[model samples]
Target: MRSKHPPARAAEAGNSTTRQGAASPGVQFLTVPADLAGQRIDNFLQSRLKGVPRSRIYRILRKGEVRVNKGRVKAEYKLQPGDVVRVPPIRTAEQAPAPVAGDQLRQLVEASILYDANGLLVINKPAGLAVHGGSGVRLGLIEVLRQMFPESQFLELVHRLDRDTSGAIMVARKRAVLTHVQGDLRAGRLEKSYLALAVGKWPRGRRLVEAPLRKNTLKSGERMVSVDPEGKPSETRFQVLERFRGATLLAAEPVTGRTHQIRVHAQFVGCPLAGDSKYATDEANRAFREVGLKRLFLHSSVVGCSLPGGQEVRVEAPLSEELESVLAELRSGTGVPLQP
Candidate 1:
């Protein structure tokens, strides 16, 4: 039988620090800070082991190599104040360094800020930028923000938007703020609305879709969501905002925060989103492409929530120039309308 422990590597043992770059060669012991209390163990490890791959971190946790207060804990274990964590040695410097953010990108991000108060930072995140680095993406908004504000000790995403979806996203500068905002989201106290262009003209009345969604992984490792009875319960409320010759502009509010809830729900109602390569029919996508649609026609238009200090905030992001231009063309009736 194989030994359960990882192979011993020769190095000095010491307390771990938050510095990025190479992982320590020896086993490291870390004390959980009060601010980090209630964070999941896996997330905590990822934050501390900046250069380590997420897979490696999960593997360590599965093999019982990671211990909290000298006891093996699951990855979902919530960290507590004063908890001591033990981490095994692993090489991390072998990975390439994260990509640097250019000056232009920095300025764009700074200019996109919509709200910066009460421990919350909101930005009108541009399309094509991932929220965090993973897969083939070397750097994302979180990493860029880290580079931008090196003096800040903590900055974490309150929620996520798809890479192709441009809109209001919140980042918490303090742990308490993260907890409070996320709590509101879970309790349905936060209101989030998106603007979407559907391939077909939607029905006139507001509709509430109560469809359960199941996530599937294709043979090529792509993730997709579809309606299934056995899946998690999902709900989306949609209202028609405008009707075009070939498409409908709508406001979508997700009552249940399932992955791709709005996109999949729209498809379930016989109106797939325009420019959605993964979910929409090729002919529909081609038709939209012909009319100046370059990317997914989805935007996070609004987010409203109460802050930790009881102050309410409502943030909105205007449609991008490209999206606005697409609408303008549709309004002009320049191209042939798509067949229903």
Candidate 2:
């Protein structure tokens, strides 16, 4: 971990800065750097135009106001080194300075590191922490990491976990490592297992669930997923870990990487996750909250994958103290019995 800052820009002419609350005086042409190669154009714009809204960025792309190598390109176009990007004058909303991680948060993040070797870094990501900054979040795990380790040229999330889901999440320190691990993830070679507290007694016979999941966005911009026949194929294997009076602790392994697959599938089987506000019943959430469960009772307990150098890595994150306490109460028969 070196303390050097991010590399400076190398533009053909005028420098680029994220103008806020007003349009730039003139268009700017920027030469893509080697470190940014293979990144999508839209994502590049998002990084360049900090205060600009995502909708406005897409609108600029759709109308061909932004060009790559003096030619119109789609948002998905990957940037190559030395490609000149033409950016038009754009206005953005006035935004406050980006938030910096406090001392406490910095310590917490430092202490949560689970694995770091061969360009792969894993952390026991805390619940309520977003993986990346977006959707009104000023500072996320990735942003904090960049701030902490400024010398790292490339650091990106290999996969995403919901903001409320805590677990062993991977962060790639190099692009090559990211590409290799993500290839494994797409091929179903990366193994992930979660520990979930479901709302009802799980049937012993139901070990595997094959369901298709469809994602829908509400007008409020909230994302929701449900089981649908026309949705993408999904599968999850469930093994009953422990039985409670009205709740069951389950070890869930998703065979397919679908949005909200586990939560939606659990609901489909009439055993939605406890404290899952998006998919579980209010009654169940209320009961679990009363028993000291403040966050979604889902934890990425285990993550196992092979590195590019044929190294095997398996990491497990223990449950947080609050979660462990809730489980202890359930096992002691002291918590309120939840109903299906």
Candidate 3:
């Protein structure tokens, strides 16, 4: 969706040039091509209209300033092939130079490819990197990939991971693949699992958490998710993987994808994720950091999904070396068995 042109094909114009009066001011109509058929209208605008704030895009949609096939369309409307979209004229900032990726990030991304075939790229995404550029992050993983492959026609993230979470994440090289995978995700056919280090000893046996979570924005503009009765239903399954003196390693699989679902559920169980700054106590985070953990101890370890042709894809990412080092130190210090 973050492409000026329809993913990989040339888009037709509707009584206007593709870049109709971009330097001036006037409405322009664009015809969607087959390659961009399933992209959401809001996302399409975000890509086409550079330097426009997301809030403005939503406002335009709400005000009926944006239209599809001569009729007003919602922000979430999926653009259909051959649909003519009416885009209002708006001022935009001058384009800035793209940010350069650091050597460490380049090397890590280059080495993290777990699967690449049939228009899909599965990566063992590194921790501390945003998936897409925004919110002061100029060079995210996707931007880096685009820079790395300048000649490529299209590439987009299939899903998102938190900035501090490292693990298997998917990127689509083909628009069709992106559409298919997204459908699978929406249908809950895609399965994902994560490895997390919790603050306290985990109880023996499997645990299932089914809670409703609501998102809240703080005065500082920071976003948080908490368990609320009026919120959306969320579910997570946690299995104790290994135990330490005052900490536990767990395998967490989420049935419903909500913002910070696993972290909130972990906190609800009185075992907030180690090094989770938003949910865990400062004292607990400080303790874990003192023991050599510097980032959130959550990682997307496994992902499974089927492609359009019924070919299944399952990828796994091992615990990072930095995390492994911390686990080793903890194990040696406590001399605890792997499991209870």
- State the displacement of the C-alpha of residue 300, model 1, in Å, after optimal TM-score superposition: 0.6
Candidate 3 global lDDT:
0.81
RMSD of each: 4.3, 6.3, 5.2
lDDT for model 1, please: 0.83
Q: For candidate 1, which ten residues in a row score worst on lDDT?
A: 5-14
Model 3, 1-340: lDDT tens per residue? 1324432343464224323224524566678878888888876776676555556677789899887876998977988888878777675443344567887888889899899888899999889888877665677888788777778777888888988899999998888889999899888889899999998777666499999999999999689999999999999999998888779999999988898999999999888998899999888887787778899999999998888777899999998998998899888865322222
Worst 10 contiguous positions by lDDT, candidate 2: 1-10
RMSD to native, candidate 2: 6.3
CA lDDT of each prediction against the hidden true structure: 0.83, 0.83, 0.81
Of 2 and 3, the candidate ranking higher by TM-score: 3
- What is the alpha-carbon RMSD of candidate 1 to the true structure? 4.3
* Model 3 worst lDDT window (10 residues): 1-10
Stretches of candidate 2 off by over 4 Å are 1-43, 47-88, 92-96
- Which pairs clash in the backbone of model 3? none
Best to worst by TM-score, what's the order?
Answer: 1, 3, 2
TM-score computed on alpha carbons, candidate 3:
0.84
* lDDT (10s digit) by residue, model 2, range 71-176: 9999768788888887777744334455789999989999999999999999999999988776667678988888889899778878889999998999989877
